[model samples]
Target: MIVAIAHSRAQLGISAPAVRIETHLTNGLPAFNLVGLPETAVRESKERVRSAILSSGFEFPSRRITVNLAPGDLPKEGTRYDLAIALGILAASGQIPHAPLGDFEAVAELALTGELRGVRGVMPAARACQQASRSLIVAPDNVLEATRVRGVQVLPAATLSALCGHLKQTQRLAWAAPAPPYAHSNLAGQPDLAEVRGQYFAKRALEIAAAGGHNILLYGPPGTGKTMLATRLAHLLAPLDDEQAYEVAAIHSIAGLHRAPGQWLVPPFRAPHHTSSAPALVGGGSTPRPGEASLAHHGILFLDELPEFGRRVLDVLREPLEIGRVTIARAAGTVDFPARFQLVAAMNPCPCGYHGDPGASCRCTPEQVRHYHSRVSGPLLDRIDIQIEVARERNWLSSTVTAQLESSASVRARALAARARQWARQGKINHHLSVSELSLHAPLDRPTEKFLAHAFEHYRLNPRTYHRLMKLARTIADVADCPAIAQDHLSEALALRRLEVAPAWPAGMKH
Candidate 1:
């Protein structure tokens, strides 16, 4: 009797937990039994591993070989364990030395022809290997992504035979070096604010949102450049720091998203269509995968035509917005994925395309308009820090250029400076500050305090709304380079908070 063990990882949400593959051989009827809660893909690895070993010029021991994934309670899934299982068989059969096998971890899918296939969602495993301080063995195709984890020793093998030769201490494989850090240029080629004809107010709102990572809602009639403004928000923001870049890349990699190499450094901007289902928006499946929000972690989640999305679908954002994480639960268990995304949503003024437009008349009735806006519940709207209307630019065609209307480059520099101030003061952006932290960090003087109190009472503001308003004012102060919340900052934040305050959404609807 002989026993062998190899290390692998099991995919759970965005996490990859260590899995031990134990293979044993005994004197009994020729049989191969795999245990320990393996799903379809893992169970099928038996034939794949056997064929790969035999095709690679290794003897397939015809014994009652039993394989077990330890911690039988943990569900095993995917073909990522194929290489680990094959190596276990060889080490147990005396075809390869067993001692060195314990020094490394492996993740690869095996081809029947003895070639190695790259496994999806191996980035988490690569990180786990690095954290565990273990050298990771992967296919040549995966070396690029595996090396994304800086300082993790990696060996890329083209075939099982190649890997076996190296493991035998006969022909050692060359280890992979980490790829160079991706270089990112400051928002140079992206769309510029100067391209947009006018709407200085909307541009200012965007600048505040970018500086503080606050969620914003843009409401107006058609042709107001709402979508255009929302798309350019990414340009006004800072590039992802090293930690943020890794998190974004890891999330995308786990979702099996195809990313061209340097693109990972740029902040992700995901704008899902209104017709997407709730599960698609919030991330739901039998096995539970990441949704658009998780994919937008450390980035932007833009939803255009906001009211067109179902109320139920929109409601899924309530938790992730407040907690900065999304939890998907199935009969299997619950898995949480990071969802700290800045939301930028745009909606029409009413059911009719041109409800509030001075040039175009609205046909939507009062009831129809109410029903349309009702699609976005009050709770969800409350979570949004800035809710401002984007009015149609009437004079853009004939308007003169002014110094106040700067390019996105100028706005981006201001936004970055504001963000630097926030980070230096609180170690985080204004939006993430807790209620206590917001109170302590954003101190209002006697006059500003009285103004906010009077406004809150006038609006019948809820506690959440009041706190969000303060945070918004704090961001406004940050933008102005003010150390404390000023009266002007409070006034501007108050003006932006009202959803229908700016001439209403198509201000009046006929009953």
Candidate 2:
């Protein structure tokens, strides 16, 4: 009897869990069996592995061969285990020594002709291997991605024969150096604020939203440039730092975005259509992959035509809005994905898309208008920090002084300055400040407090809404470079709350 062991990683959401492959060969009928709760892809690798071994000119053991992946209930998936299994079989059959394989963790798929193929989602596994101080052996195709990590030894193998030769000291593998970091794109090329032609007040709201990391909602007539505002907002936000860039890129790599690792410094932007289901928005499946929300981690999630989305689908965002992460539960286990993304949703005032238009006449009755607005619930709206009504620009094309309008670069500068102040003072963005943290960081003067109280009573504001209003005022103060929350700042913040009450229908409305 002979036994050989090797190690690799298994895909579990955005995580990489260690898996051990133990191979045993004994004198019995020539039968091969793989045990350990492997999914279909893993089970099918048996045929691929045997073919690869024979094609690589390695001896195939004829005795009973039983391979067990340790921790039987982990439920392994994918063909990432194939390379480890092949190496294990070679070791157990005395074709290769075991001591040489101890320092490295390998993962790759095997072609029937013995070539090593790249597998998806290798970033997280590479990160795990680096953290554990183990060398990582990857297929030549995956070497580009594996080089994203530093301080870890990464080697590329082209086929089973090449890997066996390296293990037997008959050949040498070249070490992969970390790739150079990519520079951020020029912010000037981004959509400029001047392109919108008008809506200066809405532009101010976007600035505040970017400054404080706040979620916003835009409601207006069709062709009012709501979607354009969301896109420009992406440019105004700050680029991801090194740590955040790695995290965001890691998520994308797992999702198979396959962007060159260095070029992902810009924040991500995800715009899911209204017809998307809850699983596609918030994430769900037997193996629970990240949805659009998590895919936009540390960036932006824009949902245009918000009212057209199903009420249930829109409501799924409530959890991630309150918490920075989403927990997806499955029979296998629960996995959490980062979802600290700013939401920017847009919708028409009513089904007609012009219920309150100045130029166009309304054709829909009050009931229909109310029903269209009712698709988005009040609680969800309350979670949004800023709400603005985007008015239709009468001189959208006629206005000729667009060159004087502020560019995205200028607005982004102001937003970044404000964000810098908040980070310097409180160590976080204003929107993330807790109640106690706000009290310590943003204190209201007596007169400002009185003004806020009156507005709270008049608007029937909930506790959360009132606090968010305070946070908004704090952010506005930061943008204006004010040292205190003055009455003017509070008043401006109050005026920016555009959705206090849903518009009354043309017909006499009923509560």
Candidate 3:
């Protein structure tokens, strides 16, 4: 045979798009050519393919060789194509039959010794191959990740010679077994809520946030346990469902992150440093990799020392917070990554970390405090559903009165019940409810409506704040297992909007 074709996939964002590997051999001077807009890594695959074929005891054709990755305009990158290119060359040279290549898709890097090596983003390729109804061939190291996609036939190949033997019907590669059924015991361990000392109000706000998938900001003095409260919020939330787990796993795979066994179902908790750049926070680069926001999909993104981050860096998250996705456009193309993360942020009240504390004397002038608060933008504050203060626990160590605090399991039970109600009523969490859906699911009675309107008018709340307050109220009511939004629910929701209040030192700080 003078020509042969093999199938493969290319990673774009979290998606795997099909790429056809076509190889042709002609009677001419011995030379090799590769086309189709391949990037540096892919272009280097030619040498790796040549070495692998020779090392595998296969004849290398001396005729002129040409390889093309079809759909020429689509840019391809990575070493994933090495295996496919080698298989194509062997088939075209009559070393392996070309007929068996049609039923399978190959995605693996080839070593100089003809061994197969795992590549990043194999989970997405496995899913795409499953959808296309084709079996997937991958290295043994990647067998577990590929088998995670249910119903996908994964054939693990340790070396090029082994795979060729399978293709020639002389040897058969065993199908990889599917992953075991997920159990509740396999959930990732998290710090218990009981570990935190006092601050019942902060705990309450965390419960409400977890119940409705709402974004929360905890602001107080330096030693007030704001970070502690933010970290415990994820544990109060339910575990990810199968589809959500798969999505999270695929995103992690694309980012070259590996989760320990039994951690797949756990919601991700990403805490990026305050010095992280905008692209690091929102997922951008020349190649457009998944950023921290996308890494936190279906989970919590906790930003400690929130104001310490650059204003522009924080602003880059506004669009993803509103739309549940981040769209990064580069010179080549635009890529969208799922960024539906539950934001949990922690910050101090002022530059000195004690603006309103009665215990500490004010060290800075009001201007410094004002400037510190202004670093966080108003629009970004508006998108946060809950903003509560974590006051210092006075005489925390002096008093030894031991009393059992609420545990994470009990709080999670309540949170799960509330989420169940939300899913049954609207097929989504309260924070994701649309304005129209709010009218139907979160209706207010006459007196409650009047109370909410009076609060809105008094606070000069914008439409976005008003709607978010309604969602918060709906979540509070759900946690209480109430069918309707009561006046007290609205009152508590309004109280949680601490940033909306104008303080003396931090003047002009209003959501």
The lDDT leader among the candidates is 3
lDDT of 2 by residue, 242-267 (tens): 77877777777667677665356889
Question: Relative to the true structure, how large is the alpha-carbon lDDT of every model?
Answer: 0.84, 0.84, 0.88
The residue ranges of model 3 lying beyond 4 angstroms of the native Cα positions read 185-189, 398-401, 460-463, 502-505
RMSD of 1: 2.4
Candidate 2 accuracy as TM-score: 0.94
Off by over 4 Å in 1: 402-405, 457-464, 500-511
Give each model a TM-score.
0.94, 0.94, 0.95
Clash counts for all predictions: 0, 0, 0
Better model by lDDT: candidate 1 vs candidate 3: 3
Best by TM-score: 3
TM-score of 3: 0.95
